[model samples]
Target chain A: MKTLWSGSREGSLLRYRAMAFTVGTGLLLLVFVGIPIQIWGHSKAVVAVVGPIHGYLYLIYLAAAFDLARRERFPISRLFVMISAGLVPFVAFIIEHRIVASLRAEERSDATAS
Target chain B: MNRESDRQVRWVAPRALVAHLLVLCFVPGCLIAGWWQATVAMSGNGLSYLYAFEWPVFAIFSVVLWWNFLHDDPDEVGGRRLRELRRDESISGERAELRSPDFRTEDEDDELRAYNDYLAQLAQRDRAKGWRSR
Candidate 1:
């Protein structure tokens, strides 16, 4: 029952969540559908569309990850991992899941404390 | 400060100067490549058409990043202010003139301090949990 805005005191977390979802979906389509079609069917059409879309989404994902990292004061290595998550298939989903859970747990504890 | 002196000292600090020099070198290259792609696209190369527009966009983004870096204040850059604010978070500005107040009320300050402490404890716990899971 946690909201996007609930625990994100710095306001970057929600934006990161949205970007993660988009990057995750884009990568999934490109990897699962587009690459398969390009390899087996001898057609470049699916890759032609999904590849550029994923690239653009990945750019936005990088920006979002940078924003979140700055707000969280994350180390550069952690930020690099977050930014790279969008490029690999299904990694964004896992990272996003961890991020959301931690944020929610922090928020729940803060609510009880206050 | 005189305009030329200001430019030398601040606008083109050694780091910014290097960055600006790089930008100057690359923007024209990108534009030239974009132009070549445009010509190729005009001659009916489909993939070159997409890149024809893309290279120019890259040049523009580089220019924007350079401009932001040139004007950015060292202390106030990015989220530093936000981090400071969180550290000294208060509900009211009643003690604004005091800069750093020695005696803080127990209510709002306590909440923030407790939250920070909680976060520290959680981080330690999480590190332990990560090790355990591995």
Candidate 2:
């Protein structure tokens, strides 16, 4: 179609990366910083603030992952893994890194072939 | 994979079967929790009533996700049609069409299939035009 991607896929990739970074940071702070401070430091402050932020960021992460997965035609299982990656600490970072590297490689090959 | 072959594979695949079984169990668990909360709400518990609605929404969301997983097309992982739809909407300034429909109907899936077919036709025409111009 005349309007299809306007010959670009970079937009989705950029959006996905931004969301992944945000979610990953939020998750790390909640899991490592917030939880530890709440438990040992006897402070509810970190948990009180970080908990809701992490929850909301996770929801947005799910949406972002879904959008990217749809654009990339990711298999449902892969999509699930991408979505779940936001739930655990460090997983989002690893998955995002791999996704960026693989996509870049594919784009390079596509450009060469075309 | 084609629909029939996909279905056959899913049927034989242990992981798929396990996933489906988990979904079946999870849905009923959500429903039962909803029902329990609803009953508690009848006794005038305000928070329980809120939870009653939440549980069913969770169940519905799970079912929708499961259905999408089951029916997902292996070939469309490239999201070509989706990108086209977004681009067309952007150019036409017609974002309303992409918004959720106002009314749900039994034939919603059929309508979506028809829309995809239309998009595919437009894509094919565009490809032909591009070839001619080149």
- Per-model TM-score, in order, reads 0.50, 0.56
Query: For each predicted model, how many residue pairs clash, with residues at least 3 apart or on different chains?
Result: 0, 2
Per-residue C-alpha lDDT of model 2 across residues B98-120, encoded as one tens digit per residue: 43364333565987778866765
Predicted complexes: DockQ each: 0.08, 0.09
Q: Weakest 10 consecutive residues, lDDT, candidate 2 chain B? A: B125-134
- Model 2 CA deviation exceeding 4 Å by range: A1-8, B1-16, B27-61, B77-134
Q: In model 1, how large is the Cα lDDT of residue A57?
A: 68
Computed on alpha carbons, the lDDT of every model, listed in order, comes to 0.66, 0.67
Model 1 lDDT, residue A64, Cα: 73
User: Which structure among the candidates has the greatest DockQ?
Assistant: 2
Give the per-residue lDDT of model 1 (tens digit) for B1-134.
25433443375468777877979998999999999989999998776777787778768866865664565445444354344333233312323335235333355576777875675565445444421122
Per-residue lDDT, model 1, residue B48, is 73
Write the residue-wise lDDT of candidate 1 on A8-105 in tens digits: 64457877888899989988988899889999988989888877666666666776776776566554445657767887888888887776665564
Mind sharing the TM-score for model 2? 0.56
Question: What is the DockQ score of candidate 2, to 2 decimals?
Answer: 0.09
Query: What's model 1's lDDT at B12?
Result: 49
